[model samples]
Each structure stands twice: as C-alpha cells, then as structure tokens.
Target: MEKTASVSGAQTIHKAISLLKFIARFSGEGARLIDLVRGMEIGQPTAHRLLQALVAEGLVKQDTSHRYHLGSLVFELSLTSGHHFNLADICTPVLKKLADETGDTSFLFLRSGDDAICLAREQGPYHIQTPVVPVGSRQPLGVSAGGLAILSALSEQEAAAVLKAITPRLVMFGNLTTDRVWEYYLKSNAVGYAAISNRAAPGVKGVGVPIIGEIGTPIAAVTLATTISRMTEERIQEIIPALNEAAEQIDVLLRQF
Candidate 1:
C-alpha cells in the first residue's frame, strides 16, 4: 500500500508540472478548463484535481473567468533560479531605436528549447503596420526570421539536431519543411542576417540578425518586420547595416550579465 501511494503521488506531481508548463506557454493569456482537458488528454476530473493542488501551492491561479494562468510563484521562482533574466528590460530600448529608425515593428526573440519565444516588441511610427508574432508567442526554431537567425548561428551538428526535433511541428505552419528551413539558414549565413518574405504571414516580411553571446553562441535575435511591398531588395540592403549594428549593441548589453 505504501509503495502504491508513493507512485500515485509521483504521477500527480508530473501531471501538475506538465499542466503548469502548458499554461505558461500562453504567457498571461490563461487557458480554459475544456482546452486544458483536451490538450493534456486527461479526464476533466483529474485535471481539476491537479489544478486545485497546484493552486493551493500557489504555483497556479484560476481567474474569475474560470481560466487558468501561471501564478506569481512561477515568476518568483524564475527570478531566483536565474533561468530567465531581465531580457525584456535589456532589449526594449535597443528594439525601440531600431523600430524608430526603420519605421517598422521590431522584435526580440530568445531561444527556449526547440522554440523561439518573443520577449519584446516595439512598434514604429508607421500607419500601415504589419501584423506580427505577439509578445509571449512561441514559434518553432527556423520558422520566423528571428528563429532562423538563431538556428543559423548554431554549429552544423547542433542545428541539424534542432531541425530534426522541430520538423514534425512545421506542417502546422504551412510549407515549412526541414529542407526549406535549411535553405533559409544557408541564405542567412551568406548575408550575415536572416530575411524571410511572406513566410509567417501574407504580405508580411521580416529581416533579423543573431545576437551572439558567451563563447560565440547565439542567445537571441532581433528582427524588423515590415510589409511585403516595403521589403524590396534595395530596402533590405539599406537595413542590413542597422540590423547588424543593433544586434552587436544588444550582444554587448547581454554579456554584462
């Protein structure tokens, strides 16, 4: 009986942790109970019990609208663990300047496992803005300009491993196979930047440069997003220098860690 009880406790802990991570993926957007049930493939009663236990521990919270989100405990632990530093604080000013200069949206993306998560975004002084990945959104590595930049900055072997992992998720994003991602990486390496036209969204284009960190590893990338009509070859040439310069500045700032 004792051994059986211990096994059950361990399973419950695993389920709760998985649920917490799923909620974190949406950032603060929260997840409905039905969505969680379907996503975790657990019965509604089991999910509810696990969520209640997590909420009691302050690791998760349920809002008035009955949606679940990561609680303050998760953020407090992240700070203490030093897993994610003040990334937004460090990159927002640089992104703002880049956006102002280019008159387009600028984004900062950090590598999180096999995915790139948007950390910050700055909108420029343009009326016809291009819709882009929102803050806290995650994209498979090599799918977006920032993600492709990070992938290209990796060593050949490491990049191949990442491609293998994310290939299964590419179909959901349309036309983004491993072969296409490899092609993008090659183009990004040739120009010292990643440029994608109409990849993430229709009529929306982006260019990005990787921010290399300790021992020449890519910790993140900065990308500029604009409309397809504004992303001509001449414009890409003109903005490459600015993008490169911003990436360098951000790299220097992050190394101060």
Candidate 2:
C-alpha cells in the first residue's frame, strides 16, 4: 500500500507540472479551465482536483475570469534556484546598457535545452515598442534572432540535431522552415551575428550576437529589436558593434561565476 501511494504521488506531481507548463505558455492571459482540461486530455473532474491541489500549494492561481495562471510560487522558486549564479542579474546591466546605447529594445535570451528563454529585457527610448516575445517566455531555437544566434554558434552536427528536433514547432513562425533556419544559421556565422528582418514580426527587425563563454561555448545571446524603418544598413552596421560588445561583457561576467 505504501509503494502504491508513492507511485500515485509521483504521477500526480508529473501531471501538475505538465499542467503548469501548459498554463505558462499563455503567460499574461491565464488559461481557461475548460481549455486546460481539453489541452491536457484529462477529465474535468480530475483536472479540477489537480488544479485545486496546485492552488493549495500556491503554484497556480485562478483569476476572476476563471482562468488559471502561474502563481507567485513559481517565480519565487525560479529566483531561489538561480540565486547563486543568476543569469538575469548578470544580464540586466548589459541589457540596459545596450538599450541606452542603441535606442532599441535589448533582450537577453539563454539557451535552455532546445529552447531559448528570455531572461531579461530593457526598453529603449523609442515611442513605438515591438512586443515580439515577452520576458520569461520560451521560444524554439532558430525561431528568433537571439535563439538563432545561439544556434549558429553550435557545432554543425549539434545544430542539425537541434533543428531536426524543433522543426515541428517552427511552422508557427513565418518562413521558419528547416531550410530557412539553415540560411539564417549561415548568415549569422558569416556576419558574426544573426540578422532577421520582418521574420518574427512584420515591421520589426533584429540583430543578435552570441555570448561566448570562457571555453568558447555559447550559452546565451544578446539581441536588439527595432522598427524596420530604423533598421537601415547603416543602423545595422552600427548596432552590431554594440551588440557584440555587450555580449562580450556578459561572457566575461558569466565566466566569473
């Protein structure tokens, strides 16, 4: 009976975590309970029970609109886990400096498995904003400038494997087929940064440089996003220096820890 109970507990924990990830994909817009049940392919009653348990643990919260969103506990745990060598803290200053220097939104994305997670963001002085991907959101590598930069830094064999794994998720991004991803990879390798114009978002362009570690491994990328009108050839040339400088600074800092 005790062994059976332990197995059941493990299964419940797995289900709860899966549910949390599904809810996190929605980010600011909490997911509806019905949608959660359907997405998880679980009965309404079982989903409700699992959710209630999560709510009790403060890992999930139901909004007034009956939608569930990730709770404060999730953020708190993330903070605690990375407190020793925090990527956000290390990249925040670099992001701010980039935004100030270029007057374009700056972002830091860290490679997490085959996905890239937005670890920090700094808004520029421009009145118009490009809300392509929010902080804390996860996007498949090669789908965004930052991700593509990191992807390009990988070895040929490693990059090919990652692209194959994430191909199914690339359909949502315009012109992000496997061949197109390789094109971006080659461009990034040639220019020392990844440049994408009107790819992730129309009228928005970006340039990204990989943050190389002490051992010459890329662990993250620094990117600048701006309006297409502002991304002229001259402007892109100017931004590359700033992006590369910032990435170098971040790399140095990362090596310290």
Candidate 3:
C-alpha cells in the first residue's frame, strides 16, 4: 500500500510539471482550464489539483476569466535558463530583410491546434500599412494566409478536424461556407502555398508559405502582408520567390534545434 502511494505521489509531481510546461509554451495569453483538460485528455479533478499546485509554486496564475497564465516564477526561471525562444530570434532578421526587399510587413506563424499563432512580425517602410498581428494572437486555420499555409500542410483528417472546430466562427469573416473552405485547402495543398486578401482584417493582403522540417512535415510558416492597394498580382509574384527562399532558411534553422 505504501509503495503504491509513493508511486502515485511521483506521478502527481510529473503531471504538475507537464501542466507547467504546457502553460509555459503559451505564456502571456494563458489557457482556459476547460481547454487544458480537453487538450491534455486528463480528468478535471486531476487537472485542477495539478494546476493548484502549480499556482502555489508560482508557476501559473488564474486571470479574470479563470484562465491560467504563466506566473512570476516562470519569468525568474527564464532569466536564469535563457531557455525561452521567442519568435524574434528566428524571424526578426528574415522579416527585416523581407520588409526591406519587398516593402511589406513580414510575419511568422505556427499551428496551435485549431489556430495559427503569430510568433513574429516586422513592419514595412510604407505609410499605409497593415495592422500588426501581435505575438500570441490566434486565428482560425481556414481564414488567414498564415493559418491556411499551415492547414495546407496537414493531413486531410487533421485539416478537416481543425475546420470543424472553427466552423462556428467562420461566419464572422468572409462568408466562407464549409465547402469553400475545404476547396481552398485543396487548392492551397496543390500549389504548396496560400493567399488571402482582406478576409479577417480589412485592407490587408497576405501570402504565406510553409516551412517544412527535415522530415518534410511543416513546422512553421512565413507570411508577407501588405496594404490592399500595394498588393497587386505582380507584387505577389515578386514576393513568392523571396518568401519561399525565406521559408527554406527557417526550416533549416528549426531543424538545428
């Protein structure tokens, strides 16, 4: 009986660490308890207990919505470990070069389940500009170019699941029917890239290409976003080659890690 209890205690500690790691990955915006439970596939009581322990350790905190965010302990540990890899590390230089070369905002994004999470962004020199997609902002996979690029790389089943998850929110954007969304993904898959114009955020036009890993699976995406007025078909053609080259570079870098 005592041995079983000891084993259970150790398992609890491990689960607490897993929960902390999950929260750390999303850091600033945090996560809702229900989402965590569903994503982690853990029982509610177990998840709650682990989260409470993490809170006591200052590893997580509950916000107004009762969502959990990383606490000061994570910040302190980041200072010592230097382990946090921000999107800026991999993308700032690439975005700067793209912006300088194309005079358009450059962005980097990654698939986070049903959403595309913006990891990095750099603004262009132009006066008329697209609004910045803040780091950690999440967009549904069928709408934004960055999201579609990631979706295009997913397996059919995975892509379908993501689309189903975000179906309710689709109506708010471009009158996108499910059939149209599926067709878009198919076309994007065929072309190996995706583009969108003023779908969610008005006046912005975006083109995105996936960054594939060593195993030929997508790990991230690179996007070029510009004001609608500046995004002619000729301009998109000019940017595609550069975006593809940049995606390759990022893929190589990600493989190193």
Which model scores highest in TM-score? 1
- 1-257, model 1: which lDDT tens digit per residue? 99999999899889988998888776556789998999989999999988998877657767667888776455445534653547677778998999999999998888766778787889999887775788888888898889989888876777898899899898877667888888888878776888887666667888899987543456689999998888888999999899989988887776564
What does candidate 3 score on TM?
Answer: 0.66
Q: Candidate 2 versus the native: TM-score?
A: 0.66
Off by over 4 Å in 3: 1-85
As for model 1, its CA RMSD to the true structure in angstroms is: 13.4
The predicted structure with the larger lDDT, 1 or 3, is 1
RMSD each, Å: 13.4, 14.1, 11.0
- Write model 2 residue lDDT over 19-104, tens digit each, in one string: 99999888767789889988999999989999998987757877667888876456445544856237677778888988988888
Q: In lDDT terms, how accurate is model 3?
A: 0.76
* Model 1, runs deviating above 4 Å: 1-85
How does each model score on lDDT?
A: 0.81, 0.81, 0.76
